[model samples]
Target: MSAVLELVEFDAEGFMNDAKAWTPEIGEAIAATLGITLTNRHWVVINFARKEFTEKGEAPSLRRITKTTDVDTKEIYQLFPGGPAKVAAKIAGLSKPTGCI
Candidate 1:
């Protein structure tokens, strides 16, 4: 059976305060709020961001994402349009990037 996750409230930057509350459905909702449609390509980045956060206890940096993931910086920027790391991370249900304001 699939788990049902409710729509969560996001912080000002659109990040969910509780990572455990996140789900694929919630990710889609968050993406919609940012005027984004979650494509397969977008999922690659989102999944990567979640993995990084799980292993590192912080959001993944764009640099690390590009270097480690199959996608490059150009593709990621095009996928997310504006604020790729910040936006994608938020949609991935992670906190704001450490250095972002």
Candidate 2:
């Protein structure tokens, strides 16, 4: 299976329980910061981004993410330094990147 797919298979409870890493609080923070309610769509994007990062060891670009999520690229870039990939990665509980992933 693809690395992305594999990453998607990660245990959500374990991820949320990691105090030093992905946590439920962090997810809540991201949702509030983004001014968006956490829904199935958000989960899909988060999981997809995590999968993409795991498969490539890097985040997907804004363009690709926009196409996948149908969210505005400019809006995402305004919210995240690099773009949706960066924001999505964070929401997915991935470490921040030094630059555009």
Candidate 3:
């Protein structure tokens, strides 16, 4: 199967139709993918992910995101196709980019 197809099939919570509406379950899925503990302290990941999509017009790389957050890049890529960027973008309600997604 294609990488994107496989990514879509992975056990993430819901589809990326609306990340802003993501529930705790969705957040947990994103956090699990990034190998991070999702406590109240890390809520910024969701907000940052949203900001990244709005500002950069693209998902932030795992490296770039981890530099700003506590999530790990290696663990993120292991779970998601394009790593933290993709997962973060999805959770942030951003549309999947053409080639990247």
Which candidate number would show the highest lDDT if scored against the true structure?
1
- lDDT string, candidate 3, 38-72, tens digits: 65434556666667767876656666677887666
Q: Is candidate 1 or candidate 3 better by TM-score?
A: 1
Show where candidate 3 strays beyond 4 Å. 1-38, 74-82, 97-101
lDDT of 2 by residue, 20-101 (tens): 3555456656555556556665676666666776777655666767787766666565545444565666566665533552
Best of the candidates, TM-score: 1
Number of backbone collisions per candidate, in order?
0, 0, 1
Q: TM-score for model 3?
A: 0.45
User: Deviation in angstroms for 26 in model 3?
Assistant: 8.6
Model 1 residue 87 CA deviation (Å) reads: 0.5
> What overall lDDT goes with each candidate model?
0.83, 0.56, 0.55
Q: Which scores better on lDDT, 1 or 2?
A: 1
Off by over 4 Å in 1: 1-7, 99-101
Q: Name the TM-score of candidate 2.
A: 0.50
